[model samples]
Target: MDKFLLQQQVLDRLAEDLLQVEQALREAHETATHEENIAENKYDTLGLEAAYLATGQARRAEAIRQAMAHWRQFRPRPYDASQGIQLGALVCLVDAGGQQQHLFLGPDGGSMRLLSGTQLVQVISSEAPLGRAMLGKYEGDGVLIGVGSIRQQFEVLQVD
Candidate 1:
């Protein structure tokens, strides 16, 4: 799969998420300011609750905006053997049971799955645990990742 195309797809998905978040933020803000929601007594906290929800929605919208900015500035380059696996590398790893998993290493705030043709590829940040373990690893290299108390092992099958 073309890395540039995949990057574009990620950006498109993030854009959609941003739109949704903004809509929710707008609704929450309106609800918070609505006259009907104003509290008449101390126990009546509808307006206060709505204000808190609006604040949370605003924060979520800002986060999505930042993620979109990061994705826009990101550039995916061709993989080099000397560099091993890094951001922009499409890596395939195989477990002991011969199960193959595909991952696209990318920038922050892109931990989501995408469909490339019939295969589903997981997009992750290099700072993530699995991504960190795969970094600087070449084909045929062994990768080990520990999550909580569980350990998972996989061999690098391909890097492109």
Candidate 2:
């Protein structure tokens, strides 16, 4: 598949997911409010129930909001030399030991699946180690992760 087309598809999917998340959040908030009103007269379980529902809904809503923001920023654009390793780049990398890996930058919807020999590396979001390293970097640039004992290196082979 063409890289641009793939990126756009992923972006569209993320947008749709964001919409769903928003709708879910709204429903959750509404349910929590209704529960709060019902439990208002019953002080015994009111605190516990309201706390549980509110906390869960708030956490999920925050997570989805953060993901939506990240995906919005990573939306694809026309690749220019000046852009370096912006979002939507199909990055090819080789580890120091010569193992190859591929990363398709996109949202965190459990959608990244790339083949490395017989192994598959699942890319999640741009906030991950390798993803962060690749961001704003040009071809031939090297990123070092960790130090000494757990040290690893990745060399950017190509960006598209």
The parts of candidate 2 lying over 4 Å away from their true place are 1-54, 69-74, 106-126, 147-149
Q: List, residue by residue over 43-87, the lDDT tens digit for candidate 2.
A: 556545554766775676576567656655665665566878865
Quote the lDDT for 67 in model 1: 82
Q: What is the C-alpha RMSD of each candidate to the true structure, in Å?
A: 0.9, 5.3
Off by over 4 Å in 1: none
Q: List the residue pairs that clash in candidate 2.
A: none
Task: Estimate, for each residue in 1-160, the C-alpha lDDT of model 1 and write its tens digit.
Answer: 8888788888899889888888888888888899998899999888898889889988987887888898889988899999999899999999989999999999988889999999899999999999999999999999999999999999999999
